[model samples]
Target: MTVDVRLITESEYPDWLRAVHTGFLQPPVASDEEARSRRPYTDLARTRGAFEDGRCVATFRSFAQQITVVGGAALPADAITNVTVTPTHRRRGLLSRMMAADLAAAKERGDALATLIAAEYPIYGRYGFGPAAGVAEWTVDVPRTGLDRRWSRPESGRIDLVDGANVRKLGPDLHDRFRAVQPGAVGRDERWWATRTGAEQLPDHPWTEPFYAVYRSPAGEIDGLLVYTADDKWGDAKQPLNTATVLSLIAVSPAAERALWHYLCSVDWITTVKTGRRGPDDLLPLLLPDPRAARITLQADFLWVRLLDVVRALEARTYEAAGTLVLDVRDADGLSAGRYRLDATPAGATCAPTTESPDVTLDVRELGALYLGDASAVRLAALDRITEETTGAVARTEALFRTAVRPWCPDVF
Candidate 1:
């Protein structure tokens, strides 16, 4: 059967939405309200669909984004999301076609890189994407945290239970401050806050009214925000056994993080707290008196990145020490393949194409993994994913690329 893969028109949006839901194993129906709610934010030019026999069988979309690199430099990124392929359309190269088109356009538009939250582990590597960051979720046994039962207020800041309206008003600016210092972080749009705060609602996925709490410093400045929901549970004898699950938590300061966590563990009848996805090396576990009280519930790769412009991506972030290296980046798709010389110093960095002998050779996907500074070149070399042509090149790469703290992308998208 012949399939047509191209950008969807504005008139085909409802059908596209249905295709998306169907591909994702949702209700397989898109209501008019759902289309209308999402249409304003949808860019038709960047949204593509694979149609066969007048039915959309696959869907893909990308949007403008800014990703924070090492040293807090935000680079232009093409953030891919809402990608789905119906089971019937699998193994037909539908995704490859859509990805090639989108990436070509992104490179033409001068986007430094492309990013996505991989739903599966083994799919995107063939498309020049690599796991760039990891996420961790902890389930804390509150009673074992060894905190005082009478603990209510923090020593430095105070936590206030605010409403969603207040979060919509204060969230954007606070997130900006937090993202500025966070590597691997991505910028959020206005619609993100609106939908998250329930200013606008989605039909297919209904929004629950979650409790919003904001942490204020002693000087009266908002520095942290926490959203959580509690489940009501009881034993056979009517003993309370509740779990407070954090939906989202953003803090710009360590004090704010400590205070919010302390407040959660101290809530009456709250026997457990599920800390949401956090940085792999997050302070959540260490904040507790007994670090072992916070049990690891989930640890997995979260963010994947694909480099489009090797020079721009390599030069956008800072290095740990002064060094020069010739890197031979191999890209099977030839989107970002070249031998480049990178001269990095304490002040800045410069990368450009060169004919010099390579000190190290690797694929563009591996470079994407190393770009955020969380990945270790030595480990990749040990795994045979990287080839060190010169003596001690792998160690040099490790010293230059690894950050003190692991890179974490807080938002899934």
Candidate 2:
């Protein structure tokens, strides 16, 4: 029997979701409540499935999103997720077909790029995606931090424990303020907040109530929010050996960040704190009095980007310095291929197809890496991933593309 790939009907969602779970090695089940909860947020036309013998065997979906670029401009993105193929149907071109259709639709829709969090590093590159941002995690030994255990309140702000309702009320506005200035950050929708705060729970995923802490500046403005859970353990002699794990921490200011870390370190009975995935160069370690007290647990690439429109993607970001260069962007899929001239300035940039000779020649995947100002063109050139057609073009590319602070995407998509 031949397999068919096409956009799934609303009636086929459950089968599609079950196929997703099966591909991910999870229980292949979707409850009615779960289906109801997800349907409202899903755009059915963008959800495609591969069917064999009247059953879904592969799944892929994309949604509307906005990602902040180098100078804090949010570009419309086609955010992909829930991609999978059954083991029985491996290497059958299902993923490629689904991806091609989606990318074509995205280009027609005028999205600047497509974004995803690659579960495996090697999978997305062949699809023209590249690692754009990285994440870091650390485990802190509270006893070695050398902080006052008797610390009570923040020096310049106050920390207050609030409930999920309060977080739902304040988080969206605060996140808007944070993502506006933070490169590589993506927008979060109402469903994300609702699911995180227990407004709606998906089936087969257990939820634990976490403690929420909000930091207010001296003027009483909310600038930070911390969500954490604790494991209760006791030593043989009745000493507390609890460890607090941070689920999410959002801070808009340095003072708010410092105050939250201070509060976590001083909490009674909490001997260890696990900082969840953060930006590779997060301030958590430096915030501690003894920086060595925090040991890195994870350092890996997090967000992956694939440029759909080369010209628009280049013009969407602001350059760090003034320079003009031509890029020979090679896309094997023939979606976004051509030599383009980019005239960049600190103020803004303009990119368009031109007949000018190339100064730097690179694949579209490499441009995705450089788009958010995270990856260095000079380093990629050294790796032979990029060619500098003109002397000093790589340096100019490096200077124009690199941001003072590395790009960091807090959400996984």
Candidate 3:
């Protein structure tokens, strides 16, 4: 059977949505109104649908976002999302065709890089996408005896508890201010914030009302805030459990972070607390009287990144350790294939197409692997994807690319 690929029209969006939603186990299906609302920010004109027998059988959406690249200038990036294919349409090269077309369109539109949250890890790697960021989920069992006495004695900052609805309204402004200076962070628009806070109806896991606690500085500035809820019965009923969960925590400074955690843990009648997302270098443990009370588990959560333009993506981010290096890159798709030389100094990295000697040769996927903290140059060399000329070239390259903190994505697109 012949399959036709074309842009989806507004009238045919519902059919396209149905096809993609069917592919999701717990699809966050959007209403016609919600989909329409998002059209302004997304590249809807490029959203492709594959039709079999004149019926939409597969769909994918691509949109542009402004990402803050570390050590280099921020640039416009393309994000591939809502990629889905009906089960029956699988293995027919439908997705391959759609991706090639979409990526070509992205390059033509001048996107430096492309990112996506992959539903399946193996599929996108062949398409030149590499894991870029990660989010770690944590569960902490706060013991009654483990509560720190220092945290129990609250200090001078005035804490005001407000309604969650009001907090939702305030989230966008706060997040915008926070992301401005935070490296490797993306801006969350009002609509994204609404969806995150559950102010608007989503497909699955409806938002639960959250309590907002705003911490004011001595000068009366809203320096920090936390959105959380309490669960009286988090542990076994026979054992009696008191747990408070932190849905989101934002603080402008280190002191604010300490004060916020202290306030949350000091809540009356709550013996235990848990936060699903915390930074790898989070200071919570440092503030704890006994570090053993806080348990941390690290799991690999992947975020894939694809460099659309080799020179542009490399020049976009800043490099910490200064070095001169050459990379021989192979692309599955013909767009980004070549040897590139990257020279780094305290100023920044200068990347360009080169025909000179290559210190290390690798595929585009290997490059993507190194772009995020997920995979190191040494590992890629061990896998035979990277050929290092010097004994420590891989190690030196890894040190140059290492970020201060592991890149993380707290929000799921």
Backbone clashes in model 1, listed as residue pairs: none
Candidate 1 off by > 4 Å: none
lDDT of each: 0.92, 0.92, 0.73
Question: TM-score for each prediction?
Answer: 0.98, 0.98, 0.88
Model 2, 256-317: lDDT tens digits are 99899999999999999999989888998998889999999999999999999989888989
Q: How many clashes show up per model?
A: 0, 0, 5
lDDT of 2 at 296: 96
Segments in model 3 whose C-alpha atoms lie over 4 Å from true places: 26-43, 149-158, 164-170, 197-199, 203-205, 232-240, 296-298, 372-374
**Shift of residue 125 alpha carbon in model 3, Å:** 0.7
> Per-residue CA lDDT of candidate 1, range 1-413, in tens?
79999999988899999988888788898989889888988899899999999889999999999999988889999999999999988999999999999999999999999999999999999989989999999999998998875899999979999998899889999999999888989998888998888888887667889999899999999999999999999989988899999999989999999999998888888999999999999999889889999999999999999999999988888988889989999999999999999998756799999999999999999998998888999999999999999999999998888888788998976
Superposed by TM-score, candidate 1 places the C-alpha of residue 236 at a distance from the truth, in angstroms, of 2.4
